[model samples]
Target chain A: MADPFLSIQHVRKSFGATTVVQDFNLDVEPGEFVSFLGPSGCGKTTVLRMVAGFEEPSAGKIVVAGKDITRLKPNQRNVGMVFQAYALFPNLTVAQNIAFGLKVAGMPKADTDRRVAEMLDIIKLPQMGDRYPYQLSGGQQQRVALARAIAPKPKLLLLDEPLSALDAKVRVSLREEIRSIQKKLGITTIFVTHDQEEALSISDRIAVMYGGKAEQVGTPFEIYNRPATKFVANFVGTLNVLEGTVTDAASGKVKVSTQEVSLKGKLNGSKSGDTLSLALRPEAISLGRQPGRDSSLSGEISEVHFLGSVIRVRVGIGGNTVSLDTFNSPATPPPAVGEKAEISFSSGDMLVLH
Target chain B: MKSGRFWAWVVFVLGAAYFFIPLIATVEFSMRMRRGAYSFDAYQIVLGDPRFQATFMYSVIAAIFTIILGVLIVVPAAYWIRLRLPQLRPVVEFITLLPLVIPAIVIVFGYIRMYGSNSPLPFLGSDTGTNSLLVIGYATLALPYMYRAVDTGLRTIDVRTLTEAAQILGAGWGTIITRIILPNVLIAVLSGAFLTFAIVIGEFTMASLLNRPAFGPYLQNIGANRAYEPAALAIIAFVITWGCMSLIQILSRFAPRSSNRPN
Candidate 1:
């Protein structure tokens, strides 16, 4: 990254004896939308707050546009933040709320009104300038908050779980709108959220955090398809793990339950008779035998879910149950629960975990 | 259910009579100064008196000053406590309640001893000093109502998030408090202000002891020497206090409805 717009270097945060964030670091390129994805109490919001100057870091520094703003007051740092609760001033009208930053900057009344109207249009709520916050819906309030944050055109934008308050449908739509707005303005942004799908769908790159540290930071494709750690793999998408013992380590032959399969150079450290966890995504496995797959496991169909576009089938082989998704075919009836089944997959798709 | 409704009305009627009968009696007696028929003669006499005008004006000024002082001191204290030092809330509540628990006579006497003419502060040595002391005493008397009103207002909004939001928007502390925090809590502050006004206007113990020519002292003096004028004054005072209460109710309708509720 050449001269990243925002750089957080070795930032650590603690409250008395409890350390929340530890040695966190990330560089966000200009106009790139990055997300800090993690579970609750995982210190994702704390890192974003540190960048917004709400919480000062215990160590290291934050440089935004070549200025070290670690110790500056939040007012001194020209950053815009949208809170999870949609912290719109209740007393002010929508236009006034959007113009709050401009007025604070000593902008003239005419310029403030023009800017407020422009922000209202950008958020697609052009006529809501006269309405108070209480009169707006949850989705509308969040849009107004987004508009308010960007009205002053700050150097960076920080969104702290801005879509978590909305319902499922609204959460999806608003997140897309937020992404589009971020792209249109080409502002460097940091969005903190615990929703994996939300992070994966909207972010250009994601920093998956755990235990107050960045476990993996990569593009969404890399984070989802090639997870760096076990936590990232399980947290990012649905995964199935099969416990298998290596029958022959040189050729990567492993036996799962009653069947034997060749993994072929996939296991580098495992020896014969050693137990290993072989992980696979649900889409990687196919029902019955397939032409291109080199590995096959025979089991009884334990469960079948008839979803609209896809059928989710779970096969039980001894004590291990592997879940896979198969397309819903109109020509063939769904598999029965007690029917004997054989699941096939490519040998290269199985991930050997230590 | 019918019997419950009947009994409820019965209890309400009893409560209404208990309160309104005495008030009706006072109003009736206040109109009897002319004799043989209801008349406004006593009201006319009392309203015309220069002493009444002087003392009432003094108390009104005192109430206004006391309200200003209370808001200046309490708003920042309550805001800071809610935003940064929430753990200290219980202790602050206890201190605010102390003014109510400790009798006014006890407080006035303590003030006299602490700031007498010979004392180092000497707040009672001059008229201006004594007036300041009286306003301070009234503010202490109104502390409980003012603090609770402002605290309740702060509760209805997300103080910490709003503060951070304003700060991040380039608003300094002054702008945040004056433009964001104060405007959001304006109704509650107004509620506290009116309650303070009512309390200060009718306060007697401190003003009487401090030798101030306030309405409360005047009402007491008239009650001791005159009959119908005192009755009229009592009705007027009741009207003023109730008017303040009504204003509080009316102003509350304009308070900004909060959108931030618990998820």
Candidate 2:
């Protein structure tokens, strides 16, 4: 690939004795929408701030377009940032707030007005130019904030949990709008969010962070379907860990509870009689046997949850409980608790964890 | 609920009457200075007096200087404490409250003793020096109000993020403070400034001790000699105070309201 537009190499940050981020690295292509996905205090925001020049990295270099920006001040970095709280200049009207960067750069009045109008239209709030931030709703204010950040046409755009404060419906709609706007502008953007679904929906690639390090970085499909670590598998979606013992090391066979399943080299290198952890996605398992399903286990129904379209059923096999989801149909009643049921899935669907 | 609201109205009416009755009597007494019928003779006399003009003007000038000095000292101090030295907030707040705890006379006395003619910094040696000392004293008096107001304003807006945003927009420290921060906090600063003006204009203890030609000393002098003019001067002072407070109320309507709250 050509040289990355933004390169973060071996960046680390430590506050006193507590290390917040350690050996973080990422190279983002121009116009790529990359998301740093993690829980709070996992250093996603810290990395974003370092990129924006708010926090200096304790180690390593940040290169943009092949130029080093490690020691530059935030003002000199020419980066744009949209914060979680919608930090709009409260005193200025929406138009003036969007034009703040242009005005500060000493752009001519006619040009500044034109750019402000353009930004207002881009945010889809053209009629709100004269309104103060307080007059607009929370969603509107955040949209204005996005317009303000991008009005300067900075080299890089950073969004730090911008949609975390909005409602559910607004959050979904606004994220779609943000994705469309980013594609239209073709600006290199780094989004930091703790919401897994948000990261999955908007990012071209996601870096799932844990304990101040990127555990896995890949396209959303790769990260979700083929997680590289147990942490990634557990954090990204609903997972069920089934404890089993390797019954035949030579043939990679395992005994899960009362059922014997051929792993077919899924296990890393566990010998016979050794305990192994196998993860199965809830959606990968079905309540009854289906075509092409080679593995099956009998268990008693322990719990049943009616979740509208999908009914989630938990079953107890020997001493372990496994959860699976089945589509709800009015023609058939859901299995009741204390009833015998058999769960089936293809052996290839199981993941052997290290 | 009906009884509770009725009692609330009763308490409000009683409080209003308790406060407004004295003001009504003072106005009535000030207007009855010309003859058996009410007239503006006392107001005319007080307004026409050269002493009134000089002392009132002096106090107004002093109030302006006091406000400027207060802003210079308090805005930066408050901003720095909030941005860099947040751990020192309690210490700074306690120091600002010291003026309130220590009486104005005691502070003025200390100023005289430490800054006497023989001392290295002789603030009481010349008339200009004495005026500077007076303004400093007033600034000290207004510190508590100014700091609290500005601190509250800073609390409402995330100062660190705003500063970072402005910096990323290519604004220097000066622009960040003057254009970004100052405009955001202008309403708070004006609120504090008007309060300071109201406090400094009629201040009696410090001006009397400093031996400055302020309106407070003038009002006292007129009260000692003339009867009707003193009431007229009181009315004028009340009007000025009311004007300052009214301006504050009007300005508050224009203050940048927090958009975080739902409409």
Residue A33 CA displacement from its true place in model 2, Å: 1.4
Interface RMSD of each: 2.0, 1.7
Which lDDT tens digits does candidate 2 get at residues A1-354?
A: 799999999999999999999999999999999999988899999999999998999999999989999999988888999999888887789998898898888899999999999998998999999999889988998999999999989999999999999999999999999999999999999999999999999999999999999999999999998999988988898899889999998888999887888888787678999998888999889988898999888899999999999999999988788999999999999889999999899989989877
CA lDDT of A229 in candidate 1? 84
Best by lDDT: 1
Alpha-carbon runs more than 4 Å astray in model 2: A329-333, B1-18, B32-37, B122-126, B261-263
lDDT of 2 by residue, B1-263 (tens): 99999999999999999999998998999999878899889999999999889999999999999999998888888888899899999999999999989999899999999999999999899999999999999999999999999898788787887888788888888888898788878889998999899998899888998899899999999999987888888889999989998998898777776676322
- Please, what are the lDDT tens digits per residue for candidate 1 over residues A129-230? 999998899999999999999999999999999999899999999999999999999999999999999999999999999999999999999998888888
TM-scores, all models, native as reference: 0.98, 0.93
